[model samples]
Target: MTRHPSDAPTPPPAGTDNGPAVSREEFDALFATVRAWGRWSPADRGAWNRVTPDLVRRATALVRSGTVLPMARPWDTSPGPDNSRPALHYMSELGDLEAAEPSAHKDFIAVDYHGKAVSHLDALSHVAYRGQLYDGRTARDCVDAGGAHFGAVSALGPLVTRGVLLDLPAVLGCRWLTPGRAVHADDLVSAEQALGVTIGEGDAVLVRSGSLRRRREEGAWDPGAASAGLHVDAMPLLAGRGIALLGGDGDSDVRPSPVEGLHSPVHALALAAMGVPLLDNLDLEALSAAGAEEGRYAFLLVVAPLHIPGGTGSPVTPVAVL
Candidate 1:
């Protein structure tokens, strides 16, 4: 079904609209306003500090049907323009191995998952804006060729809390949003009102633009060059709500970026400024379906990253319980 342009959500606020390029001055002003440097004070956990025991308990109570869904995309191994460094998987030992006393099978896998292919988490150290990481940590001093010394994915430990899915296409009565479309604060609020849900503090908000749906139907495109996701103007609203985590099908940045001289303004704002870790390249297609089926957008979000000490980020397989 074709959706008219009139059916789209309202555009972002002035100076951040999608039609024109946002000036560097405006972007800088907005970036500084949302910066959380020195706010958490020696706390590398960043926005995740909002997730308390009470919140976790409350979220656990939300699993009524006991439905569990894995949000990670498959570990991609096929190389393409979208997947430059395809993940590796091979059999290290087969049952036919002569040295093995009994039948045995073993395999190994690895990936540089920061790009458009693999589903992965982006730690606070994953992005640096203006030479600094979260909590005013200088990139040069903390992160090096070795790995990040501060705000490593290990510091985040495990997250168990409420997860909110803002199904943009479902709420908008469309199959999916086109690439380069931007989701603003207005879209988020409208989705909440339409879905009878509210994004709250300590919540892990996942925005579904039907990106995977589009890819499956229309074939893959270069998401790095153009993708549908949250614009920079929307972050302040989410930040004001005190969200603990942010994620989407794309990297949570609308492209070609509206901000001048900034490739991914939203990433910079969320990771470096607000200190909110990100779940990138999630397969929200299933979650979108589950939410539509139950008529509830809130669920129990569980994320466990590999315990790679001093690691910048980890390849994660997050689950959402409904």
Candidate 2:
């Protein structure tokens, strides 16, 4: 059965607010401005190549109290408005059936990630604009049913670097940003000032809009339609900062996207243009509380994706050590 866009569940009740509408021409210009083609040798790893050994060591230095917070959301296997395709989890083997001396329980888990529900990483091959991948590689030539040959997740390896949490709610003295709210570049600057932390090169910047909190307190809704996250106007700022990774409670794009005909504009800008990977649907509530308690937002962020050579991306459990 074919499900139309209107057939999907209605969005959460909220104002119809959105970022300023953007034209395709303006978007193309912005894309060119942030494009980092031919900047690095191994184009597959993209911005992650900036994270040298020294940067990793410096990130480790940020662990003060040694409080570790895992940022991945729990495996969502139940269907809901937010999770349309529930992850699959079933027992593949039960030792009791075998009547073995030693009991061993084996289970199988699978998911069609790359949606609003599961917490996952997006590789450079995940998003392409105008049929082109990062570094101006033709997507059709690199990607096929076997998977991506150019920018697969295996090339990125494990990411270890500094992470900056832009807690927008904390900065604004609110519990959460309202649905359909657009977090602009000025919001990023204000968040830096309020949190007293700076986003620099080779850093993983996590923007928390408290969306999960609202989901917990309220109910599940279609984040694709009305979620609070970064606006398209913010991409240039992140590009200028030379950030290696970007993540958020939402998929990191203001819902009802500012760019006309571009649903995930931030994804296109980050992965397709800037060559930066994205961490989506992260559970940042605990990190927010921990950071607030410690009065520090900078931490050692480590994300080790599964080594799937041809895979475009991977589900990840990103850990933050403060």
Residue 90 local lDDT, model 2: 96
Clash pairs detected, candidate 1: none
Q: Model 1 compared with the native: what TM-score?
A: 0.93
Query: For residues 1-322, what per-residue lDDT tens digits would candidate 2 score against the true structure?
Result: 1112122333333433676899999999999999999999798999999999999999999999989899998999999999999999999998888766788889999999989999999999999999999999999999999999999999999999999999887776667788888989998999899888999989999998888988987899999888998888999999999999999999999988899899989999999999999999999988988888788889999999999988889999999999
lDDT digits (tens) for residues 170-269 of candidate 1: 7776667777888889999998988888999899999988878778867888988878888888989998999999999888999889898899999999
Give the runs in model 1 whose Cα sits over 4 Å from its true position.
Answer: 1-17, 99-101
Q: Give one clash count per candidate, in the order shown.
A: 0, 0
Worst 10 residues of 2 by lDDT: 1-10
Per-prediction TM-score to the true structure, in the order listed: 0.93, 0.95
